[model samples]
Structure formats: C-alpha cells, structure tokens
Target: MTHEHAFSLHVPDLVFGRGALAEVGEHARALGLTRVLLVTDRTLRPLAPVTRVETALRDAGIEVILHDFVAIEPTESAIDRAGAAGQIHGIDGFISVGGGSSIDTAKGANLLVSRGGRIADFLPPPLGAGRTLGGGPLLPHIACPTTFGTAAETTGIVAFALDHGRGKTTLTGAPLRPSLGLLDPTALLTLPPMVLAANAFDLLSHAIESETARPFESRPAPADPARRPVTQGANPFASLGCREAIRLVAGALGPALDDPTDIESREQLMRAGLLAGTVFGMSGNHLPHALSYPISTLAHRWTAPDYPDDHPFLPHGLSVALAAPAVFRHLERRLPDRFAPVARALATDSVADALIALMRRAGLPNGLTAIGLSDEHHPALVEGALAQRRLIDNAPLTPTAADLAAILADARRYWS
Candidate 1:
C-alpha cells in the first residue's frame, strides 16, 4: 500500500466508560468554566443523561443555560439561534449532550458566536464564502455523544445542510473539533433498538468507506491551502482506526441494537463509533455518504420512531444505506481485489451480504421507495448526488452520471 512517511493527527481528550457522563462537570470546571451553554435536542430533554449532566454542572456551581432547539440536519437559522443563546448568556464554556445533530449544532453555534460570521462564510468554496478560522483559539466545548454515528465529535469539520441540503455546507478546522469527547454507554440506553441499529450501520459504513477511500497521491493538492479538507484520503493513521471500527461494529452492533440494555455490547459499539469517527473525521467517506446528502435533502416523506412528526425524514444512517447495498456490490465488482480487509473485517462471505443482513434485521429501509422516493425523484436525486464532487472525488472509483443513476435506480427497489 502507498503511504506517507510523516503525517500529523489531532486527538481530543476522549473519556469512555460505562458511566462517563458523571465526569462532564469536572471536565467543564477544569476548563475554568463559571457559566456554560448546554446544547441538546428536545427529544433528549426527558432522558436520564441530560438530567445527570445538568445536575453535575449545577452541583459544581456552574451556571447552565439550556439550548434544546437542535433538530436533525440543523439549518443555518436553527444553529444561529443556538449561537445567540450561547453569546447572549455570557457563557464561557460549552457542552453538547446528545447525538451528532446536537453536538454538531453546538460546534456550528460555537463557531459563529465566538468567532463572528454567518454560517455560509466559513463553508468550503463554491458552497459558501470560504473564510478561514485560524486567527486564534475559539471556546472550549465538551462533546458527550448519545448516538454512535456521525463521528462529528472527533472531526474538525461540521456538516450542515441548508437550501433543503441541495448542497451541504461545511465548517472545517482543528478549532471546530471538540476539546474533549465523553462516551458514556448509559446515554445510549434511551435509544430504541432500531435507532441503535441505524446508527451502527452508519458507523460500519463510515469505516468501510474510509478503508476504501482514494489515496491522497491520486489527487492534485488544493491550490488554496485553506481549502484543504479534513477528509484528506486514506492514510496510515486513519486506516488503523477505520479497520478497528469496522471489526467492532460488525461484532457488537447487532447485540447492542437487539438489546439496548446490553452494556457490554453498547460499550463495544461506543468504542467502534469513536474509532469510526476519528478515521472518517480525517480520511472521509465516499459513495454511500455522497449519495446520502441528496437522500437527506430531497426527502419529503415522514418516518417516526426516533424522529418526531413535525421533523419528518429518515435518520442519516438509514438514509446513507438507501443506495449502499447496491453501491457496495458495485464497488466490490469494480475494485474486486482492493477490499479484502473490509470483506474479512465484516466477517462475512460477501461485504454487501453482511451489510444487507444487518440492515434487514434492524428494520432499516432497504430501498428508496421504502423511505418515500419514487421514479420521479430519480433525476433530481442523481443531480444532487453529483453536486457533491468533494465527496464523490474521494470514492474508490469514479462513477458516471449513468452509473450513479443506476445505483439510485437499483436502490429504489428492495435490497435485491
């Protein structure tokens, strides 16, 4: 394998345990926080983890202002509200206490409120004004993840979908990543089985995509240094993390999702998530993730189990899988010998087979139709997926418009 001799990695103070939520206060206080903006979502308002975090912060004499307005795929307006809450309250520290959506909301809000800018200004070029975030350090925030997907907690990038996410804008930089990520298995207890399974699929997919990411040497380096992305490519450090993440997800995700109270399984998935987040945070994903953007943005249908009625749509992980079964099957055929490790790590006869089985058992949508898309949606969906050239460029193989359409068309039906 082609690899770099010298590369750098940014790692946060990651704390993982069966009950890591209890340390949120001490971590905040250690940062010399007197007041903090506690960011979460409405769904988690009644959960035990939120209560524990509040008590810990308040008990430590830290004043807490709750910003629970976060929703899935938060819009610029939603995040701005969170930024306002943080800046207006005169809070010195920040904490995100839920899934990728909540933590990512805190990341975005913290960026604008502390550094000062509309969300568009910090996004990558052609999508936003392309501003840099390197003047100085921003606020210190702790990420307490309640879900196992999204790896946003360990990444230097925050992805927000606006304009119905026709194109997702990103806020990227080392400072945008959290200072600490707390993994408490207890927080995951409230997640329903299907919820756990869906996110775990995300974790598994992230690792697989990372492992197959195009090598950095193949691409021309960005002329503008600031435009350099966190998803650089497959590298030594990232591969190690992705490999382990795939193994952990394959082994433990089934049990954890099947039984939410299985702390041992939950702990393993958490570890896998952390590894997946770290790997994809830097290495990035390709086809499945690239297609997921349009799937999420263009989604007009409603589903409820984890998401509320007003906020209707499939979750990110589930959406990522709509085209995944076909995408991976195509990938294996195109790059037949390139993914031996992935095939083995998943511990299945076929990479796609294992993925299909997991999704099948989890009640995850096996097709675009299942998630509320039809033949009429295909042309628009393909156009949107193609627009994400940044991600598509990272794919193991370059796909034509026809190829992409075929994948979507194949995804429109059952997993077969």
Candidate 2:
C-alpha cells in the first residue's frame, strides 16, 4: 500500500518561533493594513500580550480599533454583531487575538464585511461558486494565536452558528483563509486551567482523527514529489500531517496542560497545535466535529461569562473531545491496521485504548453521559451526525445507522 502522498498545502505565511507576536506590527504593515479591527473576548482583553497586539499595531502607525466583545464560544449573532462593528469602523483588515473562538469570530466578521451576506448563505460545497461580497473588497486577516488548539490561522473554514436554523454552518473558501498567522506560544502562559485543558483536547482530537481519516489505498510505489498519492478515500496531505500531529500531541499536551508555568511544555503544545492544524486543515475534520455541533446546538449548557449563549454552549475542543473515544473505537474496528500507527504515536498497545487514556489524563470526560447525553437524545444525535456529511465523508470507515447507534449507546454508559 502506498504510504506516501503528494498534495499542495494551503497555509498562511506562518511566522512561528518564540516571541512572534512582537513582529505582529511589522506583519500588519506589510499587508498594507492602515487600520485593523482587533477582535477578542473580554476575559482575554486584560491579557498583557492581547493588549500588546493593539499597542504594537499603533506603534507601527496603524490605526487600531478594538472590538473585544467576542464571546468565549461565539454564535452567529455574535459574529454578525462583530462584523457590523467592523464595517462601521471601516476596518481595513482584521486581527484575531485569542484562541479558536476569537479567531473564528474574526473570520466570520471578515466574511460578512467583505462578502456581505448572512452566515448561512455561505455554507459548504457551494461557498465560492457564485458568492459575491457586497462589501468593497475582501479585507485581509491576520490571526494571533494565543492558545494551542484549532489551527484557525491556517484554515479557510469559518464555523459559526445558525441560531434560528438550529445548528452550525461553516464557510470554506481559500480566499477566506487568513493572509498571515503569527503563532506565539508565550501568550498562552496565562490561560486559565480549564481553558488550557479544553483547547489541548481539541488539538488532540484533530491529530488523532486526521491521522486515521486517510482513504484506503492499494499497494503502489510512493509517487514523485509533484504527484500526490491517491488514497481510496482520504486526502494525502492530511494523512501525513495527521501522523506527525498525533505524535506531537501525545507527547506535548500532557506536560503543557499539567504545568502551564513551563515555557517549554507550552511551546511544545503550540507546536503540536500547528502540526495538527496543518494536517487536518487540509485533510478535513470528521465525525467528532460533526457530532459535537448538534450537541452544542441543542444542549442547554452555558459556558464562561465571555460566552453568553444557551446554544449548546460547549467549547469546540471540549465537544469534539467528548465524542472522540467512542468515535476512535468505532473507526478502529473499520481500519484495524490504522490502529497500529496511532498506537505507536500514542505510545500504547492499542489506538482506541490510548485515546481513552489520553482523554482521562487530560481530565476530559469519558463519554456523552459525562456531558448530559442520554438515551432520550440518541435519535436526534444520530440524525445530526448523519447530516454532517462533510465530516463523515472523510471517516476511515463508512458509518451506518446501527454503527452510530452503538457508538452513542456506548458513549452513554462509558464513564457514567
């Protein structure tokens, strides 16, 4: 079987390394952004570097506008509000200064301001076919990643809620990808314990899932660098990244989350996040992300003060983590050979077992029951997951209703 694949990777002009945030001002100027709308949540507003991002922009002679109203887990309404504010302020570009929520919100605002439409109007498959942005031009975006999850910086997928329509709608367009990404690990040092844990798992899930999602392949010689390998179902670029990413997450997340005070551990987590992002960003996310959306949309849970919606308020990383173990076990059965590599990355005898152990060590919940999923919600949950074909389409094995039914069923009895 061909283990090597060739594919073009879509990533921003990534500026990585320690203290990369200090160069934010220069990067913004290079993009010719005269004025920038700084998007972040209130909790992060007080963060020194988060504040410094704006200061750095001004120091570089760029006029800065602050819109720190980004909720922890932002909804479509929140994104619309921020976008309107960006338009009103005439932002030349956008700079996101937090984790996935803040970055996702900033991406949404840029879309609305540049594309001119309701968030739902741009959902997948038909995104760039004929969409027109009423706004003058596509404003550039620069993502300042402070946390170690959701490589929102390298991706063109802007995930937002569809409040009245009942779930999330994602917009995917290469033009929507941020023009630049400044990844600085130092900024994450001050994150609260829970936030760190949640985000780490989000990174972990991306790595684990992406590693196994490559489509099946028949034995063939490794292709030349320019020729991308053909897998039965998975994207080649995504598969390679997934393997490396899983290894990094397995080694980095635990130490980083356990001791946030240690810069080395933090840096490793940031590296892991980037690796996972680069891998899955191209390969595409599957079941865990798909399943998490409905639970997020339907759950009555409320997150931190920054997140004020009742729209199933679980964090993206947390939601994905909740469904991971079950999903991994289910997929493992379909692709048993895939398990060996994941096991090796995870440094365990079994991939599914390793993932469950990792979740437990990270203090993540074992199953949906831990997050309030019950027998009553099984039908709806299954329906929601099936509807997320974008994610399920990349699953290692084609999932059936019976398979999903058992997964959710096992999830209920998992830890509770």
Candidate 3:
C-alpha cells in the first residue's frame, strides 16, 4: 500500500521564436549530425517550413535525405517505411518538420533504425512485443513543429494507428523524445481555420487533463526506480506549466484563428502547446485523450477541412473536444476544488460550458453524433477507450466500462 514519494520531469532543449527554424543546421551540426533524415509530409514538403530547414541543413554542410511521405495521422506501416529509408541512407540524425505525424514518424524511424525492430516491438503488451528501449544510443532528432498542438517535439511518446483495425497504441520512453525542439510560429501561417481551432482545443485539453490527473502521491511505488514511467501523474512541476497553458489557450486561440496573420497569437498558441505538452509528459492525460483514441480510430465518414482528404479522418483535437465537456462536468462534480482553478483560468463558472462555447467558436463538430457515432457505437468505443489503460489509469477516478459508456452516451450531442 505504499505510494510514490518521488517524481521526475524531462524536456528537450527548446528554441522558440518567429524564425527559430532557420537555425536548424547550426543545431544539427552541434548534435554532430553528418547525414540527417528530413521527415515531413507531402502536404508540407513544398511549404516554406520544410524548404527552409532543408536549406539550413545543406548550408551547414550536413547531408540531408528527404522522407516527405509521412501520413497526416501516421500509420505503423508508414513509420516502418520511414525507418527503412533512414536505414538505407544511414542517417545519423533526424529533423522532423510538420505536426505530430511527422515528428512521431521520425521517432518511430529512430527506434527501428537504432534497435532493429518493428514499431510494434517497442509498444506495450496485448498490442505489441512490449520491449523496453535504452539498449543503445538512438540517433539525435530535432523536431520542428508546424502546428500548434500535439507537442510531439517535447514528448517521449509516439502514437500511430495499428494496421487492420488493431486500433491506436503508443510507444513511450526517455529515448523516444527529440534531442531538441524548434517552435517556430511562422509555420502556422498556412494553417486552415478548422485546423487552427482543433490545435487550440488539443492544447486546452492537455492542460486541463494534466492539472486534474491523479496525484503522484496516489500512484504505487515502482518496483524498480529506474523503470519509473514517463507519466508519473500530477506533481508540482507539471502544475506550473498547466496553469499558463490554460491561460494562453483561453486568451490566444480565438485571435489566432480569426487572423492567421496574427503572429503574436500564433506565438502564444505555440508556447501554450509546449507548456501543455511538457505538463502532460509528466502527468499524462486521462479520459478525454483515452476516449479520443477510439473516436479517431472509428471515424469512417468524417473528414476535416484543409487536411488530407485521401481518407476519412478526424483531427485529434476534435475527437478530444467531443468528449471534453462531459468529462470535465464529471470531474467538476467529483473534484470541485481542482476544477475551480481551471474555471478561473477560462473565466467561466462552469468548465464544461466554457469548453462547449469555445468549441462552437472554433467551429468544432458538436459531438460524437456529428462525427458519425451513435448509441450503437458505445460498446466498441468503450472497449477501445479501455484499451488505452496508460491514459485511463491517469484519471483521478478510473472509469469502468459502464462509466465510459455513460460518458459516451452523454457525449452523443453537446447542443441542439
């Protein structure tokens, strides 16, 4: 019955500003990268962000190999392909430019190239081989984010959809984090309104979930101190970042969405994403993020604007947003004290109501029904969410199958 008495925090070296991306070559050289794999998506390959990084690397005399086929919501096969490219090119380092997909793809590629295994070999059990990392040194990676959410640059987590309905799972460890992160706000200029809005919600949810996650003192002591999980639940270190992230999202998301040219807002949102990601890296997210995995996996008819339309897709933020109001309402009732600070940050009496209002302003879909789920989907949704035990267990109160079903049921429709 012993509880954990210690916690740890980890963050990659960070450079944040308007033109921070231009320094990629200098940083890559500092990391001693001679040949680097430049990971990005086809959508971003022609963009200024990718081009700028490529030019910077070449200018600094680093050999660059381009892998621009990263999927918008990275798939296991796609990541494997990226890893194969790195192996073939004998890349000594990685530079990921784009959103979470590109960064996560690079992480998977680094793991495979360094460890000589498939992505699943490093995942948790019942889904993969559950192998632990740290066997040897992984190639250095510098993550340059184009979007304002997911914060893949600062985290040690890599999430991707498993092939053939296996659903989504994650690989997490200290070795998976990027060697450094470049948060350049200029990359957000081309973001579509809906994409911007979705990113904002994701940042918002990360802060809230981390702020209210189970306390570190509530977790059982790890049998091996060295094997302490990346997500150790809430602690004082995480709370500091969470508070600022919530405030930034509240004040800046709308302005950033309304005017893509607003560099100030864009900078704020990027900073918020970094803070929230850093917090969640320590505390982890709970029900909303867990629910999002299934919601994203099961989405068949939903396609977001300004995203790749090659397949039916749901942005990660919208899926999280669909269930956030209901989940926070449950939390407010159960832990009013913890909920109070969040409400104050959002400047609302009800955190749930505030989220709904923000979602509407951001042009997010109303609920699960709007994204093609219904009462019949609840069972599968519950099963899918429960599989994300890593995130679900982080909640202050763990939800049962029945509880998850009820939450999905309540999430069916946010407003008429």
Candidate 4:
C-alpha cells in the first residue's frame, strides 16, 4: 500500500444498526439543536422510518420544519428552496433523513444559508468561478442515511446540477462533512429489488475506486490547504477500509436484493457502504464516478415504480456501473501488479469480467446504450467528463479527451 508523509482522515460520529434511527433525535438534542431543518424528498416522506424520525425530533422538543420537495439529486433550485426554508424558519441545526441525495441536500442548504452565496460561488474552479470559501462555522448537521450507498453522510462533497440540469459538479470543504451519521438498516428493508441493487452497485464501485485510486505520495500538496478534497489517494489506512468493505459487499449484495426483508443482509450492506465511504473520504473515487456524470445527466428520463413521475431519472449507481466493466479492464493494463489483489478479491483473473458478472447478477445496465446513450452521446460524455477535473485528477492516470472517448466507445456494450 502507498504511504504518504501527511494525510488527513475525517468521518462523522457514527451510530449503526437496526434501531439506529431512534438515536438521531437524541443526537440532535445533544448537539444543542432547538430549531432544526429536516430535509427529505416526496418519495421518502411517506415511509415509516421518516415518520419515526419526525416523531422523535418533535418529542425531543426540537421544532422541526420539513422541506420535502428536494429533487432526487438535489438540484441547484431544490437547494435554493431548502436554503430559503432554512432561512425563513431560522434553523440553527440541520437533519437529513433519506438517501444520499437528501443528505447532500441538507449539506447544500447548510453551506448556502450559513455562508450566504450562490452555490456556484463556492464550487471548485473551472466548474464554478473558483471563489474561496468563508472561514465560518457551518450549522451542525446530523446525516441519517436511509439508503445503503453514496455515503454522502460522511463525505465533505456536495453536488449541484448545471448546464440546464444536464451536468453536475461538486463543492468540497471539510466543514461540509456531517457532524454525525446514523445508519439504520430497518429503513432499507422496504427497498425494491432494483433500488437495493443500485445501492449495492454504488458500494461495489466505491470499494474498487478506493482500492485502486492514485497513491497519495504522488499527489502534490494543494496550494490552499484549507479547501482540501475528501479523497487523497489509496493509502494504507484507506486500503484496509476498502478491502473490508469489498468483502462485506461481495457477500451481502445478492442476498440483500433477493430477500429485501432480510435485515441482516441490509445491515451488512450498510456497513459496507459506511466502510467504503470512510475510505473514499480520505482516499477518493476516480473514473467510474467521473464518467457517470454526463451519462446520467443526458440519459432518457426513466421512471422507477417506487419513485415519483416528476423525479424520473436513472439512478447514479446504474450510470456508474454502466462503464464498470470497461473501466476495470482498462485499469488492469495500466496498473497490472497493483490491481492483482482487487481482481483476486472478486475470484477472477480479469477484474472486468468479475465486475460484469456481479453487475449482471444485480441486473444493472448492460452498457452505455442500455442507459439511453448512443454513438451520438460520446462527444457529450467526453465533454462532461473533462469538466470534472476534481474527480479526474484523482485518478492514477489522467485521460485525454480522446482517451475518455475511447472508454465511452468501449462502454457501448459490456456483454457484447
């Protein structure tokens, strides 16, 4: 494993297990939150877990104002609306109880309301105006992640939509990490098979990305140390988390999807996601996440049974997995010796074939075309990927526009 002279690790104060949702209220109270802004989405609002969170918040004497209209990805407009609500309610603390999107929405709102700026003004350069962040205390936020992946509850990154909601970029800083993370497997028992599979897909991607990320020793020190990214590189500390997460996810994904009501499988998958997220927090994700942005942004709007019609969109994990096979194969040649263990972990000589088999079992997208992209989308995909320099730079190898185009071309059909 690569070791660096200096590296920083950050994680939320974590509470895990079946009844972990019950602890969120007390956590908020302990943090001295009197007026709290609870951000969720229309889809999750009707669930029992959300109801329990609300009841607990109210019972704790915290005045909770619900912001339930957040987009599935928490678009710029949705964050604006959430921030407006927070400003109007005069909230001193924040709570997010849903998937990664909801947790990101809460972080977005906290950053906007406390710092007072347009979201673009605080984003990383080239994506935004490259405005410097303010040195001020952000409102304390408790992230209750009902979903099994994305690990937004522990990361310092928050994304916002751009280019007419056809692209995405992130705002990163240490203050953006949640003060606490509550992982409750009971909240995930009701997930449909497809959704459950998507969550596992993300966890799988996170593990591979963490294990194969650029070595921290090779990265140059940031010019501005205060605004560092959550991921550094694949260090010894991060490798342990990534390996354990991979083991847990490899064992749990199929079982959890097949038996949605199996709380034990869900708990294990949740733990895997948390472990993976913690690793990426200190040692970032690379190409899979970077390449997914445009494919997700420009894909045909498809609706899932459990999701809202207005919220119709491809899940991020599906988009990320669309190119997984191609990515693993491409990287195997680039870092043959380093990736041998990752390939072995999946019980195969070829990481690409292993990833393809796992994704097929989970029933994820077969390729870029399966997600509604086509030959016509290649240029656009490269363009979108190029704009994501933050994620792109974290890779052990940087892809030229032509390199990205080739990957997208190869991703046109995974099983072909």
Worst 10 residues of 4 by lDDT: 300-309
Q: TM-score for candidate 2, please give it.
A: 0.88
The pairs that clash in candidate 4 are 231-284
Better by lDDT, candidate 3 or 1: 3
* CA-lDDT, candidates in order: 0.81, 0.75, 0.90, 0.82
**Candidate number with the higher TM-score (2 or 4):** 4
For candidate 1, lDDT tens digit of each residue in 97-187?
Answer: 9988888889888888888877777776676787878757679999999988877789877777775445555566788888899998778
Q: Show model 1 residue runs off by greater than 4 Å.
A: 1-6, 124-127, 163-167, 221-228
Cα lDDT of model 2 by residue, 248-344, tens digit? 7778777776786878878877888887787677666778887888777656554532233444467777777777778888877777787667777
As for model 4, its CA RMSD to the true structure in angstroms is 2.3
Error of 3 at 77 (Å): 0.2
Q: TM-score winner between 3 and 4, please give it.
A: 3
The model with the greatest TM-score is 3
Q: What is the Å distance of residue 39 in model 1 from its true position?
A: 0.3
**Candidate 4's residue-wise lDDT over 5-95, tens digit each?**
5677878799888898887778899999999998998788989888899999999899999889878866887787788889888999899
Clashes of each: 0, 6, 0, 1
lDDT of 3 by residue, 191-262 (tens): 889888888888899999999999999989999887788999988889889988999999998888888799
TM-scores, in order shown?
0.94, 0.88, 0.98, 0.95
Tell me the alpha-carbon RMSD of every candidate.
2.5, 4.4, 1.1, 2.3
What does the lDDT come to for candidate 1? 0.81
